[model samples]
Target: MKKNIAKYIEQFEQTLNFSDLSWWIIDYKNDPGYFYCNKVMANTFNLDINAQKHSVVDTCPIAGDYIKNVHLASTNKANLIIKEYLELLNQEKKEYNNTFPYYDKNIDTVKYFSSKAKALELDEEGNVSILFGLIENITSKETLSKELKEYHNIIDTNVMTATTNTKGIILNCSSALCNITGYSKEELVGQKYNILKHPDTSEKVFEKMELALAKGEIWENEIKNQKKNGEEYWIKLIVSPIFNEQGKIKAFTTINQDITDKKIIEKLSKKDKLTNLYNRAKLDILLEKELQTFERYETNSSIIMLDIDYFKSINDNYGHLIGDKVLVQIASILRSNTRITDFVGRWGGEEFLIICPNSDIENTEKVASKLKDVLEFSDFGMKKNVTASFGISSYKENDTVDTLLQRADNALYNAKENGRNTVELIP
Candidate 1:
């Protein structure tokens, strides 16, 4: 019987040496303090690896203390699993498995491991005498899982997110989305996605979005949406198509950023502070778009540049406050007189521009003449009637924004050169 036990011990040592796992055995019958610890396990705890057995008090004090005190010391949430696992290993006769953290004194770092242990031997009284254990390092996997959980938490808090089926029915929405839209998750789920769409948003925009989605392509846009309170808001939305294993579209995920305040700031930035008219920068952009339209479709368009006649003298005669009021009134007049398709902006100090789309030189000249007549008769809150000189330029085959504006500027110069309150056209 002693010889058979000796041969089993030799075979176990050979088995431990041939494998890459960390393995250990504890003996509590004949030698309570002495235990078999393979090289991997010994080196993990900075123990004497060459020795076949370790003494608990002298050779591996840290290891012994850790194993003995783990249940008492591991009261924190991060180590609760380890404590329970140790209890089961010590008390139960069956195998138990767990993942826990261990402090390695050799490298002075905490390493995670998936470990299992069982009672390997029982004494005559059926009390546990020997225990066998195996552990595998899983620090990297735990670390990655922790990082991914953190990232998910961050996105859930900050992004207005939702998932929808292919039919545009809402499946789920994040809390942030509910907060921004003033809708509860229960109200949003199982509803069509268009419930939040503002009427002012053109159907063409939705058509384009649907077209892109049908192609399994991502679509991004700034959308005007209405909240539950009927208040309007804007969102910069990105919709991505989720795919299945066969690469077919399964669902769609939307990531949205609340951009209402940004849109307000941008609108304010594009307008004149006092007059609430588009400033020169915005006018330049509008003019470029008009130019592109003309170049693409050969559509007729025109630019009308006008300024208050003797505007400096009006400022000199009355206070600048009255002059500002006069400008405001004139802006209102221009807005009321122009067609809905025309774009009006305050070009600069005392100068304004109107971009007329799909209008020829003759039609634009008629528009300038009409505006000139309207200004000549309008009251500007002053004793005298306010008048303005108008300059008109129609789009040519190869006209640039600069060249177009320059021609209108020259036409305005000609109008001012000829007389103050007249209309002039440069074809």
Candidate 2:
């Protein structure tokens, strides 16, 4: 009988050797229980063949309480497979499944484990023997899941309207983004956001966009972008970044609102109510920018200041209605003669200012002469060959806005001095 029992024990040990799981058989009824540990279990407890006679408690001091609990559960034949015990084991078999303070020589750090324990019975003597368990590492998983959920929520709930990200790569976009951009989720992924860049948008503005994104800065501004149908519209965009576990930027998110109608209203605000020419407010802004460009690039530019000749007589004799028609007709002539780059604005009542960027003194005189000739050939209802006298001044370095306007005004006096229907350059 003893020989057969030893053979059975050897066979059981051999069976455990074939698997990766760690296990051990404990004789609970015996004082200082007998332990038959598999290779994995033996390694876990740092036990050798010579240490077989020692109790499990003596060999694995950290797991002493866990073994005692399993023994107590075995006395009642309670099932304990992966059940929580006071001593918990982690996924790594090198450590006990317990939350006790212990120094790890390998990692030089303290760690904890929550383990699952099971009771196994062998023999009819009611001698509860064997405890089985498995441990899993969950610290990193718990932290990562929490952070990922937070990031997902932010991307999913963006307000405003348009889709954002460089190249339209929708890292995180809201329903509003999809609606405003006219692109489905599947269509927007990995696409350039600038695919919507409007033709009217200057290249310089796009360069700023690239610079801002590259530096990890938010870019908030109004930009003209195209729709899926190639129609242009304006949007106010606020673009920001998304960071990952190590604080590295992983993606970009943008909130945008359509502002085309607002932009139209703004443009209307800068125009003269009657003639539709830009008003003085717009002219001042244009002049200031052009002057800065001239100073920076050392470019030549000219200003033509002019007024309709004898405008009071027409309003008094022919009524304000005819005067209005004459003004509209003059505006149409000016618009037709000027290049698209020139700024033509109504400088309050009959007076007009034409800014010619990159035009020299001689070219300005020629343009002014052409303006006088064209108006002379055109006849009004009863005004009979209405004319305008122009004062031209070429921009010079260090000239302030007031100085430039004064020079142009002096040139107008010269034009009136020379002849009412003639053009003259300021001396």
Best model per TM-score? 1
Q: Give TM per candidate.
A: 0.67, 0.49
Those runs of model 2 whose alpha carbons end farther than 4 Å from true positions after fitting are 1-158, 161-172, 178-195, 207-220, 226-233, 241-251, 257-270, 282-301, 310-341, 357-359, 375-386, 394-404, 413-419
Give the true-structure RMSD of model 2.
12.4
Candidate maximizing lDDT: 1
lDDT tens digits, residues 102-220, model 1?
66656666667777777766767777677667877788998899899899888877789999999999999988899989999999999998899999999899899999988999999
Please give the range of 10 consecutive residues that has the lowest summed lDDT in model 2.
Answer: 86-95
| lDDT for predicted candidate 2 compared with the true structure | 0.69
Residue 129, model 1: Cα distance from true site in angstroms: 4.9
How far in Å is the alpha carbon of 55 misplaced in model 2?
Answer: 49
